[model samples]
Target chain A: MDHDSYSDAYLKGVLEDVRTIAVVGASDNPLRASHFVMKYLGDKGYTIIPINPGQAGKEILGHRVYAALSDLPEPPDMVDVFRNSDAAAGVVDEAIAAGARVVWLQLGVRNDDAARRAEAAGLRVVMNRCPKIEYQRLFGEIGRIGVNSNIITAKKRPVKPTKKLI
Target chain B: MSEKKSFGFETRAIHAGAAPDPTTGARQTPIYQTTSFVFDDVDEAASLFNLQKVGFIYSRLTNPTVAVLEERIANLEGGIGATATASGHAAQLMALFPLLSPGDEFIASTKLYGGSLNQFANTFPRAFGWKAVFADTDTPANVKAALTEKTKAIFVESLANPGGIVTDLEAIATIARDAGIPLIVDNTLASPYLIRPIEWGATLVVHSTTKFLSGNGTSVGGAVVDSGTFDWSKDGKYPALSGPEPGYHGLKFHETFGNLAYTIHGHAVGLRDLGPSQSPFNAFLTLNGIETLHLRMERHSTNALTVARFLESHPAVEWVSYAGLESSKYHALAQKYLPRGAGGIFTFGIKGGYDAGVKLVESVELFSHLANIGDSRSLIIHPSSTTHRQLDAEGQTAAGAGPEVIRLSIGLESADDIIADLAQALEKAVG
Candidate 1:
């Protein structure tokens, strides 16, 4: 699969299938990227399991924070890696070991070798993408904030928002 | 956002920045008439306030309806993002707010809308201490010569307001690029239907959506679009975009938002503090107006050419300055930039000078004697007597609004009726 660009249908399918997400490199600071992604996903009805070694055994967004993916009570449907390109190589192995269905690399974090390895292991791989941004773009939420969602459709969006907007 | 394929201009015009209402399935974009939005809890609210997540928090910073308009304008202009404002002047201020600090300077074309010219030449320099160095951008060399160490951007109208002069965008863009600064184009007159300045390398495009974009003169609004191509981080010149912002806990906009830095800053800082946000209702009206932008521009261009031809041949006319006419000196430049049509507004000199110009505006029955333009109804004005009244004689003449000049914003009226009305008005004024 070309990790560079994913079709809208592919992204929507993945988002629809994933109910639980494990955010690696999650931060407690409100300004950090990982913390906001966790909050947005949690608000959007996703069961977010935040993984941060520094904040392990603590509560983040009302969910118990874990040091690593192995400590989770159950394997998440998606492993969102928020680490740098170098750290992603190690995180990809952990995601495969955790029996996660998908591995997602945050924006500006792309390791082709790691992505290929994850794909060979039968785990779906998406690189240089943010799950939160994809969810908003596909579901017509990003358009509300004046960013080009790039998905043009005349069809009415589902009356029920999958997550909270207000 | 998938990059598989792109939609055509007409399709994008109607559909871009809009989707069926997720809640009610309303096909049209409804005016989200509200002052504020509700947050689920304190965490989400904090996320919004911190710029960690993108969502509506307040009407001053962002609104649903206004956001749709901003997205649509950005889409139309091929920009990465946009911020809509209360008026075109507000848009100009927003465009310059991030790039210029106190004592910083930018170069602007002398040939511009009288209000914009005044804003740059008088108001901004006096009020904000941001100096605008006026240059005759028709000759691209003049733009290059005016640049100084303090210059942060080059500003020009794609198609000049009253004179119908076409700036050499690509040439000026190259100069701006060499200087490591952005080129700002006011695309108010030449709507995207006629020309998109970004395609020719404009880093930012501003619009008075009050004009052609709104098409009927019903709403007063403006927009600043970021092409998202310029690198704000290179020289450390634009600190507002490249450096850490104080208000958002030292958040570096270009680092945080990438291509969307300027637009986000325009809303987060410019609109929030200046309080020049576009009203939700005005945005809705402008949205509806833009749906038929392609159609109206086609008719407006054709009708304007017809009127320009008639005025060019009339014995009572001194000279016609419409770029659509082959007789115009700027005709070749117009063909290069605005091939669709030369837009709907142009200036001409009447035989009897100032009195003749004043009489013609008064004598026209079909044309509204008003200060506004881009209306569906024909409109006329004597700039020397009204719009350019504050400028000195030399200033007025240099801006292509001499004492003899009469400007007409040709509307989507029948070509024959428009010509006949001008003919009768000319005869009465000169006879």
Candidate 2:
């Protein structure tokens, strides 16, 4: 997100302050981006609250999936908007109503009006970037696809060459 | 792949480590449940006690039935030998204990199970003064970056629990070789049926039989398998194997037992002191669990793919993150490491925000909200609150478990039924 004052550091701060994230629009499809992103983030350490109106009352990642942010047991640190640009505004409205301190839009998902509204309400706004990807990158989790490269392609490790038979 | 004597995994599962009772003609290996074995007169007893004779003198040091399970797993893993332990976590500890000592260190993957993270970050540091540093296990560079002068091992799970992210065993093994240490892989998720870390160059393998190994979850056990690939006597780096042992009256393990000494010491010293021996019942259950390992693992992978696909297509889903999916960044790695199929777990984000997520979980029908994984029945959890709750907010994000994520471990149930259950649950969540 390229908001003038909103920096990656600021987004990181929001991510840092977020003890738990309510992921709206969680999908079950293996091919969908959100499914793995949720698992990735969940694996990293965030308590992911899976939100999908279509899958309400079902558990995802062992947590209850609420239909709306208003139905959660308590206010979460951030309400991650995973819906389309069109549906994002409504989610942000609920996020504001739920007393969430931040609203993050996933990568390729942006709504200026929603960002404006969320920013206007004093909630942190991060648009078009995944917390999972950002976390890995910012925290050095994005090491080179450093497997079997036989060379230190990732993370700048010095690679020793194997001796060839004479 | 060895042509010595081929048998089906089932046949090998039962009879690999055992021999028929010569006197009674019993098919099963008898559980020698005595604490100490009686010797025939003085000479035989002296040889046995002195480690000169290859025989069992005590259950704490060795047991006939436990030995059978260890052998069977060794054969299954294509490893040289194996050691059975009280728990999977204990297996990991024993595997490294012989290679490292106080003031020494090891490099580990950050993607390790939380208990292991706790074991390395807090427990091992406090108890043994042996330090462990964690790097992002997903990337080999991070693991290499974490290495230090005192480091002796690079440890990771073949298929990390909960997330089911398969580690690049060959890559990690290469690093271990370069670092002159062992690559100890916890092969609990894939089991022997799905993938063998040893074949991929892992120096040692460990398992938690409580999970898929004991498929029905009826047992609590662990095993450590030595690939016997690393020669401890090569550079004198390992004193435990090269140096004389006071416990055994200055008998060097490599000189005496050669390839098998590591397993021998795990029993002779590790188990005896730690007293982490598995019970006969749990071992038997795990043995039974092995019978259908191949079948269960296949079904699990198929079901997981189905569930992941369903979550991806749904309007409520913001993204799906199974490596099996073409869109996943880990897809290539999964293809490289887990060619047969990726294991059964993955996570996804929900659409409506936090409250919608709470409703969705409450609406699920068949999926159990539990803290365990690799069960026959599907399991789900929101890690930020449940498993990794102790981690502060920043730690959570660093661990890949940001809030707004839900992890699912698919089960062996029919794929369609599983999807339908999630479907109705999603419908209920949104409505």
Candidate 3:
């Protein structure tokens, strides 16, 4: 579905009201792609509950990081899966048991079985798209390039052909 | 969110402005490119004149197209109200006019756009006898120390221009609240997609729609967003809100408009008198840009992170400062405020130094060396020679555009292509 199909009333009720999101496979390292994504979504008014067994119970982005979805204070609105495909099915099962309303896999992290299982559990499925990117795209916030340009950005230069001297 | 419960962003973007246009039953907002509106009768004109009714009387005050754009922006920005202006600078000025007067001051970050630095250092003092005390905005302590009784507000960019540095907004917002002043953030770089300054305690938000919102290098425009949380009524300093307006006889804005007082006043006073309203055409263009902002920002961030890492390892590169890169001082902060992505723009210096920097920019085929950022096509500029061309040596260094610095507004192009172009340019520069 196109982003424009999502009205503000829908966004406000379902999107903005997403109080907590458990981002599975979250990394502690600042350079890790997952780390920034969690931090960004958290900062964007969502309560990001970081999930990583390696760094479970440790604080990430000032929120109490957990090892699993079940460890969260309450069921999150979304469980954003960022793990490899091999383990996604198990993660989906965990999400179902944890009673999450939605399951989102990050770009390039896909699992059909896990997606199916989550869908069976009556959860919203968003695969292969980053929620942050989705938020901007949906809200009409994209910065377009080239199309709206009429003014030449190039300087009025004194063009001279390169000449070889004997 | 599903279609039943949740619609996509593209859907929300188009239909967020109330319903279908009543005038022509237009499903989409039509660009009403006109200067004035006519009244049905003398009494109707009198109602608009008295500020007792809501209707478009002048394009400068309100236009059908501009109103749709304003409402869309306000919704997207998570603001209660927004005012569109002719340029980003105009938006800043219009937001400030309501609060500040002669001798009144504002505290600002030194790490700002060259244009903003020039605006605060030069234009503000001369324009209104108003002055800005520049302080380092990165630290919470430094921001707090800069506050004073004379200060009317605290202004900063969501992300510093060119520098690609993220501001500590929550702390600054807290400072503004404690001091009974508004925290105004220029969210031009870290557009609402990356971070919403309003939710993070910013009382007012300003944007230069010329950059990211318009995306393409189209028309110049600016916007002011009110969070509807700042208690303007509590402050006695703002006579514009509390006192009677000469235009409207004894109608107190704070008493009447309440949360929307600034928005109404901005529409009625700032745009009405300053006549810096944004064109409907520009607003339409910006709205189109907004629809793809999220997708573009994602690609831009990924491309930037890839490019930043590539430069960090390149032999011909001196230093790169992209928040996505772990080495950047702003990386930790970037993670805090903008985890989804650290924006599309990054800055670096060439190993061959200033002359090589100049050659690299001139040699690039794919990269359009320009002043603007957040473009879909990759852009390169040796700031010392272009955007920061006017700055002296010291000022140049302070703005993160040292003699060797080459700023890159990473676009949505293939990462390999962008890298190859840079590599070839570097090779040609050194040779």
Best by DockQ: 1
| Chain B TM for prediction 1 | 0.99
Give per-candidate clash totals: 1, 99, 24
Off by over 4 Å in 1: A2-4, A49-76, A83-99, A158-166, B1-4
Which digits, one per residue and each the tens of the lDDT, describe model 1 over residues B1-431?
A: 33456888898888888878877889998898999999877876887888767779999989989988999999999988899999999999999999999899999999989999999988999999999999998899999999999999999999998978999999999999999999999999989999999999999999999998898889999999999898899889999888988899888888666666787788888998888999999999999999999999989999999888888889999999999999999999999998899999999999999999989998999999999989999999999999999999999999999999999999998999999999999989998
Runs of candidate 3 exceeding 4 Å displacement? A1-166, B1-11
Worst 10 residues of 3 chain B by lDDT: B1-10
Query: Residue-wise lDDT of candidate 3 within B1-431, one digit each (tens)?
Result: 22344334445555444334444556555788888888766754664675544457888888767776676666667776788899988988898989888998899888888888888888989988889888888787887897778898899888887767888888888888888899999998888888889888998889898877778777788889888777777758888877777777667776555565788788888888888988889988887787777777788889999989988998888788888888989888899999889988889989878899989999999999888887888998888888887789898887787889888988888999999999899889977
lDDT of 2: 0.73
- By summed lDDT, the worst window of 10 consecutive residues in model 2 chain B runs over B1-10
DockQ of 1: 0.44
DockQ of 3: 0.01
For each candidate, the DockQ is: 0.44, 0.01, 0.01
